[model samples]
Every structure is written in structure tokens, then in C-alpha cells.
Target: MKIKRVSEFVSIKRTVENGTDEQLLAVKAIIGNVKKDGDSAIRIYTQQFDGASLESFTVTVDEMAEAYGDIDKEMVLIMQEAAENIRSYHQKQLRSSWMTTEENGTILGQKITPLDSVGVYVPGGTAAYPSSVLMNVIPAKVAGVERIVMVTPPNQNGKIPAAVLVAAHLAGVKEIYKIGGAQAIAALAYGTETIRPVDKITGPGNIFVALAKREVYGDVDIDMIAGPSEIAILADDTARANEVAADLLSQAEHDERASSVLVTTSESLAQKVAAEVAKQLAELPRKDIAVKAIADFGAIYLARDMNEAVKAVNELAPEHLEVITENPMELLGKIKHAGAIFIGRFSSEPVGDYFAGTNHVLPTNGTARFSSPLSVEDFQKKSSIIMYSEAALKENGAKIATFAREEGLEAHARAVEERLK
Candidate 1:
């Protein structure tokens, strides 16, 4: 990791947006074929990519029960606790339909409705993410989504990970499918003979899945076009080097493109953190991936003072931001952008990733500059509610017609004008 002065650090936004043309073409072709051929296309792609010959894509209730029983009893208990925490946290985010009545009997408000069906795309092959299953599924359940379908690549033996299936069941998700990549997104976006189309898709995956989500945006709503994971720490002299190093490595191990940064007022602390990162990197099981990530994207920014450090933190707009300073919450108001903010040294990034009761599926790259974490709101749709009494319309119709006429919309003007008569 490089220890650079904050003034000398260059922005890496362009590097984060680097998606290849070939990947786009391949993803587009996969989505197109899946849209055209349905389950048959899914089977062909599953065999070609996942090395599994799947005659059926659905995971039946019997299979779900068997997977739940197959997992260790202790692990099941832990997942149940995690699911409860997730449900409790997201339950706070559930919205209600609201309307306001005026003196003139005019009524206007927003109607909050959960989607009829939603699909959660879980990534497979490299890792097992039961945590993701809990994070994505619990929020929708809290929002009262009627049907929740989960899709993931089948293992070589045409089986889903037992822990994943168990987590889904714990979170109250009954529909599970063994299709992945662009095909899964297509199956969820466009209905197939075996799979039903969904109103929205949420969850994270590889570049191919991200591209597939990008391609299927209008046909089906998606969470966001997520990039590589990133974390930026803003600290002063009060922060510990060992804790900081561990937190940075936590996100770095996620991908070679993942970024880890430290912006601090103390140059001595900067040097200490760099040394600590190297020391901890040597001890990580995913050392190879973390090493490349740290080499390519990790850095310590030595700010002249705390104000400058805060400036850099906001500029990066990292997915995860940790404030390990004398008074962490004091600076919370100053932070304008971050998908999730962790305060104090004891608040580690991994806590939010798994059991801390916050969404781990966050806006990556600099998308944190404008977006937010996945929540119950992501599974919700809002419709405007408007009602006007005859007297209220008579009072405002001419004004509305004149405004429409100003925009050269004759029909809109006439629609409002008709009410006047």
C-alpha cells in the first residue's frame, strides 16, 4: 500500500467504471437468448458456464426441507438469529400509505405498495453467501412482498449450497431456482415456462450479472449497477492501527478491484496502518486477492488536519466509511456521502456485512455519492394519490389550464377545461 499525502492522491473513479466491451456483448447475447428461449436457454447456459446439466430449474419444497436438515444444527441457529436481527432492522424501514386532506376537501398523498413478486440473484461458484440471502430476503419480507423468488447457480452436482437454501427458508422465502448469470436475470425479467417474471431484481453478482441487470433495467426494476466494493476510513490519532488494517482488509479480500483507503491527520498513524496492513495481509486466508487489491487500490492519505481528511472522505464517497476519531459522531454531520457509515473503532465493516442488522448490499464505486444501501424501500413502489372536490377543481381549473396551455399542451388544457363547465 502506498502512503501518499492527501494533496498528491489522484481520483480513481475512471478505473472503477472500467467494464469491457466483450463482457457487454456476451451478457447481451445471454439475456437475449434467455428472453427468446426461456428455460431451454437457461439449461444450455447452465451447462456451458456452471458445468451442471439441469433438466429442471426449480428447487422443490422437499429439496428445501432436506437442505435445511442437512446443515449443522448450530449453524442453523446462528442464521436464525441473523435473520431476526435483519428483520428487526429493516422493519423500521417499512413505509405506509399516507394521504393528507386539505380544508377545501382536496386530498393528496403517496401510496406505498410492495411489489407483487421480486427476484434475488445470488452469486455462486467462488463462494457461499448465506448472509446475502438473509440481507436481501428479509427486507422484502418485511415490506410484505407477496412472492419472493431466489436464483443462484447450481453446484456441479446440480445442488444449491445447503446453507443458502436454509437461510432462504429461515427468511421466509419459499421459491428457489438453480439458474444463474444473465439467464437468471432474464428468467426473472421475462417470464419463462418454468420461471415467473418478477417486478424487480435485487442482489449483487459478477460483472456479467451487473451487465445483465443494466440491460434488463426497464423490463424489470433493479437495485443498482454495483461496481467493486470499497471502504474509506477517516481517522485521527485516537484510532488503532491494527483495527484499521483489519477493517480495510475485510473489504479488500472481496475483489482484486476492491479499494481500501485511510485518510488521517497523523502521518505517523498513516505509516503504522500501512505496516499493519502488510502484516495482516500476510495472515489472511484470501491473501492473494487481498494482496492484489491492496497493491492496486489501497492507500493511506496523510491529511494536514482533520478537516482535510473529512474533505477526502466525502470526495471518495466510498461504499463503507469508518470514522475512528476522538468523537466519531461529531463528524457524522459533515459526511455528505457514504452508503453506510461506521462510527468508532469498535464498529467494524464486517459487522454490517453479516450480523449488525444493516444491509451489506450497498452502492459501490462512487455510486455512494448518489445512491444508498438496499432496504425495504428498494422492494417498494410509490404511487401518487390525488383527489379534488368539485369546488376545489372549480377554484383551480383555469389556473391549471393556463399552465398547460403555456406548455403548448392543448389536450392537457382541454382536460382541465372540461371540468370548469
Candidate 2:
């Protein structure tokens, strides 16, 4: 890998913004079919894409119990601990309703209510992360969502991974279906025969899944249209090249499309890191993928100084940003756009990805500039409550009517005018 100017490293467009008409048309057809045919459509798509024909989509209690037994009991215990951490972190984000009474006796407040049901999509076909199951389900559970249904593509054997099933069980998700892709999204957004519709859907998938979420957004609320995983490391002279290389590979191994970038003020450190990345890439099991990702999207930058480095961090707005320096926390206030910031050498990216209490589901691409990570709020809605008193309305009626009249909204003015006279 070569070091480039930080300005040149940014992806030109939103990753989600670009999609071939053919792909979109194909996804649209899948969504339409699932909406029309329901469970039958899901079964057919599973057979065609996953190479598995399923008579039933729902994962039965027997299957879940078998899954728990199949996975290592030690791993299950660790997942339980991770679930507890995720739950504890998200419980703090739970909101409550409150009301206030003014001197005029007008009541105003905002009411918080959790969504009735939510669907979570876990990708299949060589993509599986038990950590994702914990991250996605626990937040919804903490938000008091009544139902958390999970959908995942089945392998050719027509089975979801045992780790995934075990993680879901520990996270308190009882409803899981063996379906995936655009059809599963349609089933979630618009109900099917066996699978009930959900108020919202959250989780990651391939491009088709992201597009499906984009298409079905209005029908059902979605968390975000996430893209490939990305990590940006802003390191100074004190940063270790080997440690930096390891962290970059952590995200790069995620997929060939994933992006890993380093912005450093030390030119020597940049060269050493690029070399260390090459050295370490040889040892990784996902070396082929990490190599392609590093070759295609990964970058190392030679920033003139820390100030210039901060500009690059804010520009890319990566899903994960690690600041490794003498005083990493000192740069926290200056950085503005990363989804999650990892400070110091010990606080590597994977720490947050799996074990850290922070939600791993983060805004990808440049969406971190505007969007946020998955949280309890994603599973809840707020309603504004306004109770107008007679005295308050009488005091402000003409003013409200005059304001409406100024905008040429005659009916709106009349609606308020009726109370004035």
C-alpha cells in the first residue's frame, strides 16, 4: 500500500447512492412478489438463492434448543456476558414520558412508547456474526419492544448457524425465521402468512438487503442503509506501526469492500504501518479478502500535522475511528463525525466491535456525518402532546389566526378564528 494525501482518500459518493438499474429492478421485483405472494414467495426465493427449499420458515423451539447445545457452552456463556453488557448500556437510553403544567393551565409534554414489533435481518451465505445478533436484539429488548423477530438466510442444508441461534436466544429474541434477502425484508415490512409484519427492521445485509431496506422504508421503519465496514485511524508519532496495522486489518477482514485508512503525521510511521500491514496480511485467514480490500479501498495518508489529520477524520466519517497517540483523548473534542471513536493503543477497533458495551451497528460510508448507531431510540417513537386551555387559547387565538392568515392558509386561519369570536 502507498500513502496518499488525506484529501484524496475519501469515497466520492455515498456508497448506498450507487446501484445499477438492473439490481434495483431485480430487488423491486422480489419485494413486489413477496408483498403479493407472501410466505410462498419467501420459500421460493430461499430455494433459488440459498439453494435450500424450506417447508417451514419459522425456527422451532427444538431447533433453537439444538442450536444452543451444538455451540460450545463456554462461548454461550461469553455471549451471555456480552448480551448483559449491551442490555445494560442500552437500558440507560430508554426514554420516559413527562408532562408540565403552565400558569395558563395548558398542558404540554412528549410521550415515549416502544415500537410494538421489530424485525432484525441477519445475513447468511458465508456471512455470520453472533455479535451482531447480540447488538441488534438487546437494544430493541431494552426499549421494551413487545416482539423482536429475526430473519436469516439458511444454508444449502436449510439451517441458520448454531452460534446465531444461540445468540438470539440469549438476547431474548424468540421469533426467528429461516429467510433472507429482499424477500425477507418484504415479509418484515409487509406481513406474510407465517411471519408477522414488524413496526421496524434493523440489521445488516448485502447490497440487495440495503436496497430492499431503502425500498421498503416507507412501509416499515428501518434503522439505516448501512454500507461496507470502514475504519479510520488517526495516529501520531507515538503510535505503534504493528498495532496500527492490526487494527486496520480488523475492519478490512470484514469484506473485500471494507475500507481501512490511516492518517498519520509521521511519514516514517506511515511507511512502517504500510509494510506491517503487508506483513500481517500474510498471517490472516481472510488474507485474500483483506488484500483486495487494502488494494482497492484501503489507504494510508501522510498528514502534515495533527490538525490536518483531524480534517481527514471528519471528512471520511468512518464507522470506526481510532486515535492512537500520546494523548488520544485530547483529540476527542476536535473530532466530529466518526460513528465510534477508539482512543489509545489498547482500545483497538475489535474491542468495540464485539466486547465493548457500545453498539457495533454504526452508520457506514459518510452517513456518519448525519446518522447515528443503532440504539434503543431506534426501537421507540415519540409523540408530542399539547393540551390547550380555554384561557390560553383565548389569549393567543387572534395571534395564531393572524399568523396562519399571513401564510394565506384561509382554512387554518378560520379554524383558529372560530374560537376567537
Candidate 3:
């Protein structure tokens, strides 16, 4: 990791803003072909990219039973525990449909309804992320989603990961498919002969998956166009250098494009943390990925003071923000943008990623500036409810009519006028 002065670091833009239109176009073409050609396109893409010859894309119930038998009992227990924690957290975010009526017979409220069906895309290319299975499915289940379907790429042997199957079973997902990438996304967005269409899609994948979601946004609801994982640490002189370095490396090991940055006012601390990172990288199993990530996107900035450090963090709008200052609580109010905020030395990123009972599927690529972490709210839709009595309409109808007429919408005014009469 290289140390840069705060002035220079502040002037540089975060990497999230540099998306290419070429990638978007390529993704759009893939999505279009899949939507138009259906399973044929899916099969061709699956064979071309995944090197699998699949007779069907859907995973059968018999295969799920086989997966359960193949998986270890201890792993099942762990998945149960993680699923319990995820369910408990999302249960708090469950909302009820409500109605309020006044004495004047005017009723107004909102109806919260769970989506009919939702699709979860779990990546099977690199490794199985059973954690993501729990995070995505539990929220929709808690929101009362009727049908929760999961799609993941099958291995060369044409089998889903046992861990994924166990997690899905724990999360109450009855439907699982052996398909992935842009084809799976297209199948979810537009129904194929075998795969049922879904109302929404959620989960993270590579650039191809992100681009496919961007293309299918109009067809169905999507969580967010997630980019690479990133973590920004704001530490003061009181913070430990080794601990900060370890936390930074935790996110760096995720991918080669992942970013880990540290902003602090202490010059000695910066040097110490950089040295500690070098030492730690050697011991990590994913050292090559971490080293490349650190070399390209990671940085340790020496700020003049804590205020400057916080300012740079806010501008960065990182997916994960760690404040390891002596008084992390005091600076909490100053943070304006972050997908998830971890305060103090004990609150590490993996805590939220695993057992902390918060969703780890957070906004990335500085999208925390406008987006939010995945929650039960993503699985539910709100419909406004308005019921005005004759007297109530008489009282407010003229105002509504006037507003409509001012906007040159006579039909809207007449509708209100007719209702009042």
C-alpha cells in the first residue's frame, strides 16, 4: 500500500464513476437475445460460458434431496444458525398494511403487499456463497413473498453446491435452478418455457450480471447494480495499526477490483499500517488478489486532522465505513453517505457480513450516496389508499379541480368534479 497526502487524495475521484458504455451495450445485447430466444439462448450461453451441457435449466426436487444427503450435518447446523440470525434481523423490518379514517369519513393510508414472486441469482463461478443465499432469501420470506426462486450456475458435473442447497432449505426456498449469468437474469425477467417469470430479482454477480440487471430493470424490479466491494477506514492516533490493516485486507481479498482505503491524521500510523498490510498479505491465502487490489485501488492517506479524514470518507461514500477513533460515537453524526457504518475496533466488516444480523448485500461503487442496503422493504410494494366521502370531496374537490385546470388537464378536473357531484 502506498501512502499519499490528503490534499492529493481528496482531488482524486472514487473509481465507481468510471463505468464504460461498452460493457452496458454488450450486456444489453445478451439480455435481448435471451429475452427473444428464451431457453435456446440460455442453453447456448450456458454451454459457451459455463461449459455445461444441460438438458434443462431448472433444478429438480430430487436433486435438492440428493444435495441434502450429500451435505454434512454440521454444515446444515451452521446454515440453520445463520438463517436464524438473518430471519430475526429482517423480521424487525416487516411492516403492516394500515388504514386510517377520520371523523369526516375521509380514509387515507398505505397498503404494503409482498411481491408475488422474487428471483435470487447466486453466483456459482468462483465459489458458493451460502451467506448470500441466507441474506437474499430471508428478507423476501420475512416480507411474506409467496414464491422465492433461486438461480445459480451448475458446476461442470451439473450440480449445485451442497452448501447452497442447505442454505436454501434453511431459508425456505422451494425453487432452485441450475442456471446463472445473463441468461438466468433474462429468464427471470422474461419467462421461459420451463422457468416461471419473477416480479423482482436480487443478489450480486460479476460485471455481466450487473449489466444484465441494468438492462432488465424495466421488466422487473432489481435490487441494485452492485459494483466491486470496498471498505474505507477512518482511524485516529488512538487506533491500532495492525487491526486497521487486517480490516482493510478483509475486503481486499474479495476480488482483484475490491478497494481498501485508510484515512487518518497520524503520519506514523500511516507508515505502520502500510507495513502491517505488507506483512499480513504474505500470510493470507488469497495474497495475489489482495496484493493487486491494494496496489491498484488501496491507499493510506495522511490527513492534517480528523475532520479532513471524515470529509474524504463522506466524499468516497464507501460500501463499508469503519471509524476506529477514540470517540467513534462522536463522529457518527458527521457521516452522511455509507452503505454500512462500522464503529470502533470491535465492529469489523465480517461481523455484518455473517452474524451481526444486518444485511451484508450493501450498495457498492460509491452508490451509497443515493442507494441503501438490501432489506425487507425491497420485497414489498406500497400502494397509496385514498377514500374521500361526498362531504370531504366537496370540501377539497374545488382545490383539486383548480390545480388540475391550472395544469391544463380538464379531464382530471372533471373526474374530481363528477365525484363531488
Candidate 4:
């Protein structure tokens, strides 16, 4: 890891994945075939990509029961508690439909309505992420979505992971499908013979899945085009170098493209953390991936002062930010841009990822500056409410007509005038 002055540091720029021309053509073909052929197209693609031959895509009650038997009782209990925490946290974000009425018999407000259906894609290849299942589904459930569908690739044995299925059951997902990749996204957006089309899609997947999401965005609403995981730590002399190094590696092990950085005022701590990262990197099971990530994207910036350090952190706007100063809370207001902020050494980044109530799905690659973590609001849509009484329209009709005609909207002007008459 390079140690440089904050003034000389530059945050790396990352755009949403634009697949190669060949991949784009491939995705388009897959989407077209799924739209045209429906369930048969999905079956062919599932066997070709996932190496699983399945007669039916739907998950049955027997499979759900077997999934519970596959995992231990303790693990189920843990996920149950985690689900409760997630549900409780997101419930706080729920908003009710509201209206305000005036004495003139005019009413104006907004209506909040949850989407009718949603599809959540859980990646299933090298690793199984039950956590993602919980993270994606609980919020939609909290938002009162009536139908929630979950899709994942089947293993060579033609089965979804037991843990993933257990998580889905715990999160209140009723519809589960054994399909993945771009075809799964297409099925979610356009619908197949068996699977119903959803109003929105959320969750993460491989490059093909991402490209498919980009391809189908306008047709059905999407959460965001996510980038690799990222973490930035702002620590002073009071912070422990080993603890900081461990936290950085937690994100680095996720992928070779993942980034872990440290910005600190103490030169001694900066050097020590670099050494600690090297020491810890050697012991990790995913050392190959973590080493490449640290070599390419990891760094330690030596700020002239705490103010300079905070400014640098704001410019980076990483997905995860950790403050390890003596008084971490005191610096919270000074920090402006981060998907999720972990205060004090005790509040590690992984706490929010697993056990804590906060959503693990967050903006990445400097997107935290403009976007936010996924929440209940992502599953709900808003409609403006307008009820104009005869007297109210009589008073405002002329002004409304004049404003519409100013924009050359003669039809709009006449529509308002018709009400007045």
C-alpha cells in the first residue's frame, strides 16, 4: 500500500459495467428468446449456464422443508433474529398516505403505494449468500409488497443452497425459482409461462446479470447498477493498527476489484497499519483475491491534519466509512458522504453486513455522494393527490389557463377553462 499526502491522492473513477459488444449481443438475444419463448428459453439457458437439468423451475413445499432440515436449528434461529432486526429497522422508514385540506374545499396531498410485485435475484455460483436473500426481501415485505419472487441459479445437482432457501423462508418470500443469469432478469422483467412479471427488480449478480438489468431498466424499475465493494477508514492516533487492518481486509477479500483505504493524521499509525495489512493478508483464506485488491486499490493517505483527512474522505465517498478516532461521534457531522458510517472501533463494518439491523445493500465506487442505501422506499411509488372544488377552480382557472398558454399548451388551458365553465 502506498502512503502519500492527501493533496496528492486521487480517487479512482468507476462507471457501471458496459458489457463488451459480444456480451451485449448475447444478452439481447437471451432477453429476446425469453420474451418470445418464455419458460422453454429459461430452461435451455439454465441448463447451459448452470449445468443443471430441471423439468420445473418452481420451488415446491417439500424443497422448502428439506432446506430447513439441511441447515442447523441454531442457524435458523440466528436468521430469524436477523430478519426481525431488519424488519424493525425498515419499519421506521415507512410513510403513510397523507392529505391536507383548505377551508375553500380544496384538498391536496400525496399517496404512498407499494409495488404489486418485485423480483429479487440472488447470485449462486462460487458462493451462496443467504444474507443477500434476507437483505433484499425484508425491505420489500416491510413496504407491503404483495408478491415477492426470488430467483437463483441451481447447482450442478439441480438444487439451490439450503442456506439460501432457509433465508428466503425466514424473509417471507413465497415464490422461489431455480433460474439465474441474464435470463432470470429477463423473466422478471417480461414474465414467462410459469413466472409472473414484476413491477421492479432488485439485488446484485454477475456481469451478465448487470448488463441484463441495464438492458431492461426502463421496462421495469431497478434499484441501481452496483459496483465492487469499498471501504475507507478515517483513524487518528487513538485507533489500533491491527483492528483497522482487519476491517480493511474484510472488504478486500470480497473481490479482486474491491477497494480498502485508510486516511489518518498520524504518520506512525499509517506505517503500522500498512504493515498489519500485509501480516493479515498472508493468513486469509482468500489471500490471492485480497492481495490483488490491496495492491491495486488500497492506500494510506497521510493528511496534514484531521480537517484535511475529513475532506479527502468526503471526496472519496466510499460505500463504507469507519471512524476510529478518540471521539468518533464528534466527527460524524463533519463527514457528509458515505453509504454507511461505522463509528468507533467497536462498530465494525461487518456488524452492519450481518447482525445489525442496517441494510447491507449500498451504493459503491463513489456513488454514495449522490445515492443512498436500499430501503423500504425503493419498493414503494408515490402519486400526487389533487381535488379541486368548483369554487376553488373558479378562482384559479384564469391564472392556470394563462400559465398553460404561456407554454403553448392550448389543450391544457382549454381543459382548465372547461372545468371553470
Please report how far candidate 2 places residue 273 from its true position, in Å: 0.5
lDDT of each: 0.89, 0.89, 0.89, 0.94
Q: Which of candidates 2 and 3 reaches a greater lDDT? A: 2
Residue 247 lDDT (model 3): 96
Q: TM-scores across all candidates?
A: 0.97, 0.96, 0.94, 0.98
Best by lDDT: 4
Model 4 regions lying over 4 Å from their true place: none
The lDDT, on a scale of 0 to 1, for candidate 4 is 0.94
- Evaluation by TM-score, superior candidate among 1 and 4: 4
**Worst 10-residue stretch by lDDT in candidate 2?**
9-18
Better of 2 and 3 by TM-score: 2
Candidate 4 residues 1-421, lDDT tens each? Answer: 7898998989965555788999999999999999999999999998899998899989999999999999999999999999999999999999999999998999999999999999999999657899999999999999999999999999988899999999999999989999999999999999999998999999999999999999999999999988889999999999999999999999999988899999999999999999999999999999999999999889999999999999999999999999999999999999999999999989999999988989999999888999999999999999999999888999999999999999999999999999777
Best by TM-score: 4
lDDT of 3 at 31: 81
Give one digit per residue, the lDDT tens place, for model 3 in 1-421. 8899888885223455223788777677778898788888888888888888898877778888898899899888877887888899899998898999988899999999999999999999658899999999999999999999999998877888888988888899988888898889989999888788999999998878877887789889999877778999999899999999999999999988889999999998899999999999999999999999998889999999888888999989999999999999999999999999999989998998988789999988777899999999999999999988878888889999999999999999999989776
Model 3 TM-score, 2 decimals: 0.94
**Candidate 2 lDDT tens digits, 1-421:** 7789866656523355447899899999999999899988988999999999889988999999899879898998888888888888898888899999999999999999999999999988666689989999999989999999999999999888999999998898888999999999999999998988998999988889988999988888999887888898999889999999999999889888888989999999999999999999999999999999999888898887899999888988989999999998889999999899998889988888788789999988888899988999998899999999999999999899889989999999899878878
Worst 10 residues of 1 by lDDT: 10-19
Local error of candidate 1 at residue 32 (angstroms) = 2.1
Itemize residue pairs with steric clashes in candidate 3: none
